[model samples]
Target chain A: MSARRGAGVALFVIPALLGACSEEERAAAAPAAPAAVASASGTLDLELRDSLEIGLELLEDGSLRARVRAPRGFAVAADGAELSGVGRLVELRESEGTLYTARFSGAPVGGGPCGAEPVSLALSLHRRGDNAFVAGSLTPYCGADRWHGRPARTPLRLTGELPALAAPR
Target chain B: MSPPHRAPLGLAGAALVASALASSPAAAQEKFALAVFHFNAQYVAGGTLGFTLLPDPELDLDDPTTEDRIVTESLDPVLELYERHPSWGVDIEMQAYLLDVLGERHPAVLDRLRRMAKSGQLDVVSFHYSDQLFIAYPEEDWLRSQALAAETFARWDVPLGRSVFCQEGQAGRGLAARMVTAGYRTLMWPKNLLSYQRSEFDTDPFPLYRLGDAWMVPGGRSMDVTAGSTNISVRWTFMDDGELLATNDMNPYFPELFRHDPASVAAYEAEVAALEADGYVVSTVDDYVTHLETRITPREAPPLLDGTWQPGSTRAVAKWLGGKGLWPEERDAHVRSLDAAARRELVAAETAATAAGLDARERLDSAWRLLFLAEVSDASGINPFRGEMEYGLAHATEALRIASDTLAEAREALGLAGLAVDPESDAVTLATGADPLRGAAVAEAPLAIEVHAGDRATDTSWELVATGHHRVAIRFGAGDERQLWVGFPGDAAAPLVTTLALADSTPVSFDRAGFDFEEFWMALPVGLLSVGTDRFVIKDQATAHLAARIERGSGDVVFEDQTAPIGETATWVFHVFEGSAVDAVALAGRVNSHRRIER
Candidate 1:
């Protein structure tokens, strides 16, 4: 029933953003021209602060909506963010060559170096040619603590090439 | 390992293996008959349009491209397949309009179909021409639409199936009641070919189980050659295999399998055989129902439920608009527009036309037929394939147009000009017999009349003014419109009425189009009969203003003025519109103790 769910896929939900803006405000916020992502298939895995790693698989279900997964523990990547657990990329659209906007959310288990903090990340990405970059404010508290109503976030940014990969299921 | 006197050890082991094989998950094969249910639906042009900006598909009967696909592609291939495999049956679902189109485009194919139908090699499935949801229609409207479909098939000498198939194979609450009343036995879910509801069809011990008074055949995985290469191969699961039916939309199937690949066909047959050998029996849905009827079960009946096409969420349809799909806000807006128009114009017009006597019956039916076709469930919204929804809106608008025209005709025939209730005068003016076309007929005779407005003003000696025979103007002060009554002098040879008391005061014809009037008197024996416009309003003056349909049984006709009170003389009252044959006869019959209009 929530806009965050669809056909067994854990849809991308920017809870804070969704709750903060009305439909009109969101429409107004949409960029007049979003950049385009290449027709080729690819993946973007970025290692962030405290060994945190995020992986995005460009999935094809007729059109390009990505399959996303996140790091385990609270702070950093443990065994590298595996492209497991399918999550939908929301607002995955391209406009005005080389400008695209999309949002992703994921919370996978097991982060060794980050000390199993059970982190959950929500990121908004912009793609320019082969290069796709995302910058988001991450909550320092683990997903477990957040579940108990603790809110903590630190600014984070990452840029990386989207290497070609087999399309994720 | 075993006693010599007993079965040999090897033989015993072999017997155990065979037994296990028979009951294993692989042994879980059920009998399934492959029945390709074909559907070729088109949007009714000029019906209600959807809220989408998609280009609407035009309904061009002369254009072979549209209906041709239904035949050359869909039906032709199936017939060819049937010719090769006589036992493989295909069911074609169609409504009257589609059949008519088929008749025009592919008569030979249709004739072949008739032969196949006769030989039990093909089946014809009947559905509302509009393919509308039963829930959307009123009781009479629903029944009439169903009957019309049945009649269309009967007239064509084709036998229709008792089982109903709707989009998504979903039925709403009270579906059972409607189905039973219409003499239907089952509602088949076509979507079962693609989606499965484990709790409903798979998990339940019996998939073909009864739901309250009606029988439901739920979800099953359906795949066809046209389903893309990914779905071409058949996958059988032991749990949901009960009563599995395979369908092939031949014309639309992948080109590789269009002619029935020998290897693929052999493989399909092998699969069916494998299932049957394991313990399954193959039969069509009808035969399966018959089989179920012969079996006795103790499971409780499932209650009827309502929602969208699917059981749980309606998002499946909305899902189609996802990704690059912008929500069809325009589709919703168009739907609202259609609804508002129908409520304000169509419904009232239909009711009025129905009560306007035999002449207006055909017009009313035409309007209803168009309206029904425009409201198809999928074409209205569930389907976003093209501009299908837009066509529905167009059809609805056209239906409203027809209804408006019919209402005008009825009103003109009834000789209704307008009624103005001046709440300050305590008296009401009932305008009638205005001929805007030919000018108001000048009256050469005098007539007595009784006028009453809410018991405050009652005049038994009101006379028709000869000079302005077409005009009748009276203002009422603080009088309710419903309480106003006018009694015409029945004894006069004929009282000529020609105009209304409007500012223009033009003589309005009784049967011409475009004459405007608020409402008019009904069952009043005004001795004159006027034929001016092809349309007019028909109002029944009694305890309250009644819609045309409602006044069918309520209007009272009396032979003499004041001979009996309106309520007391209800029996002689036949509420015929002014231009109706009965209107003239009934008025003449009761006037001057003679001269009754012949039936």
Candidate 2:
């Protein structure tokens, strides 16, 4: 093989620190957009076709945070063996009555020159009533960065409903 | 004894044959087994800072704060794992320097290691003290470094196993010959670097081959579990990539996170089950060697190669260093300086001690140990982290000085005269005496010397000849006040030369369009340089440009450095036979040399 000099070929095998550094943790913890509501209760389960389960929770402010749980045989896509961990943060604003637009900004996981770049996902949902809702699939958008040594292009689809929020006291 | 010669086959053919043999159905019934070996050498060549971004360090050897974590987190688990799994044997090759660190700070770990060795669970193989590249230094220096490594292992009461486990799986010229001399029975290098394609490993009939006196197992297609891969069913070997097992708690492979899939463990178990069912013998590298030794009679010894063993045609150091902006000259020069100093020191210490009737083994041994500690391989120095490069260089410099000082002390104790040759500064330091040395073999004759105009000995090459009495044959050149034999021959009782100075000769200068010299002996359209009884540096007169050597009879050989002429006057250096009939004009015409020097 010809020499690949300074071609951004990171010679580091430091895979553990990927997606889990102090700076990245702080960034992932911070919400991307300001919230409109005061608080929220209950979780929204975006059940997908594959035994992959994504639990989204509405915060006190109007923002959504996700926790991913992989099936018994499978693992989280990019983070190898990380079955449960914080996934993504998206802004939730009501577009019309019973309709909501979820806006998500990319968040970097690993911290370093050669760390894996962030991949973002967005979703749109329509509420039938207070107890049930229909949601569209979240499209994974990873700009020219690699995850798990492969291009992060694997598509994600949501097949389940968002659970009812606890009624405000 | 010479190694057996295997008919060299084209690489393409070798790869195809290997690939075909890998899938052969007959292998299922045959004794197809694997030896799984795990090695952990947590070292950064220069340091974390030198290779990586500053302050953002993955591993910093200079920092004591990190050592505790490395020991408790990275090393402790592996030790514990070995103790827990007695049936799963392992061979660990630790950097001798790191072993010392462990001995000092973590004595408990040493006790554990001793226990493991006692239980026949772990065997410590011979390795470079600093994890240095064997090819980087001269053969003599390399052997000394290896010897010192054994001494370091003794410090921890660790026994030297028969095999030599080196990084990158590449052996330089004649390494096997030296290894045999050093008492190694088997040598193993990684398999990937040996061939351009991974499939090439299939062609070999067996895992081990005889190279000269030592048995060598060039990297896989061996039915071994050392290759780390999920597709062991398809891949010939089971080699681990060395990164799967985490060195610290943060590694995802940590014991807590190990159960997440546990693919490697499952793979190992499955392989053992399958191979055992087929009546194959599963064993470690050492055990495998022992097994082969016991089964194979004298007539059935492994096929030997004609010369020293070479794992691969390409050197990882050459490739890596080329990419890092440091070429062979930079590395070679530094290595040459270290080697010369060491050679003089060892010879001086031994000779002086003998003259003074004092034991010098302890002092020489100390110097040897220091030299070994400073011998960093190609895998080192490329660490982009902070402090690694500086750390290595600092220690190497200190060690060289200690060796030099010890030699000086030996000379002083014996009241023996000495000459010190400083290759870097091109100066000689002399200690005068009543009698000057005679009949010493400084270099082989007929001698050849090439000294450039500058004080730097980077361009100097010489073969010494002992002229009767106190005089030694030396070539005089353009360099002014260039000292010769500042350091006398290593012989302690031999007479030392007081001083030998060579005057700068009138140099043949070049002034014209830019010009360049080629390899030691190869010709360009303009001219050629050849090596015979003497070295020659033939240049164009337009303006002496950068000079280089080229061999005769080969036009396709690769030239090391290629630079365009800067249109400046430059002088090239060369040395020819003392009484050759070929004059400057005749020599110039032969090689198209517009400017020539045979002196």
The model with the greatest lDDT is 2
Residue lDDT tens for model 1, B453-515:
453333122223222222222222332222333433221222222221110112222221111
Q: Which parts of model 2 have CA positions greater than 4 angstroms off?
A: A1-169, B1-42, B45-52, B56-76, B79-84, B170-183, B193-204, B223-244, B247-280, B293-317, B320-363, B378-386, B410-599
Worst 10 residues of 2 chain B by lDDT: B496-505
What are the per-candidate TM-scores when only chain A is compared? Answer: 0.34, 0.40
Q: Give the per-residue lDDT digits (tens) of candidate 2, residues B1-599.
A: 33233222222223323433454433322233434333434343332222322333343222333444455654555566556555544566555665666787788987897777655556666556655544433334455667667777887887665566665443432455566666666666455433322233445334556655767665445553212211122123344423344331233112233222334444555655565455443334555555344333322122111111122322223222211223211222122222223333344444444544555566456555544544444323222121332233333333333333444455556555553422223223454321221134434434333333233233222322222112222222222322211111122221111100000111121111111111121112121222222222232211111112211222211222121111111122222222222332243332221111100
Q: How would you encode candidate 2's per-residue C-alpha lDDT over A1-169 as one tens digit per residue?
A: 0111121122111234444657667467543333223223232322221333444455544434443433421111333212211121221111111322232333343432224544443333323223243333333334332111111221232323455444334
**Position B533, candidate 2: lDDT:** 22
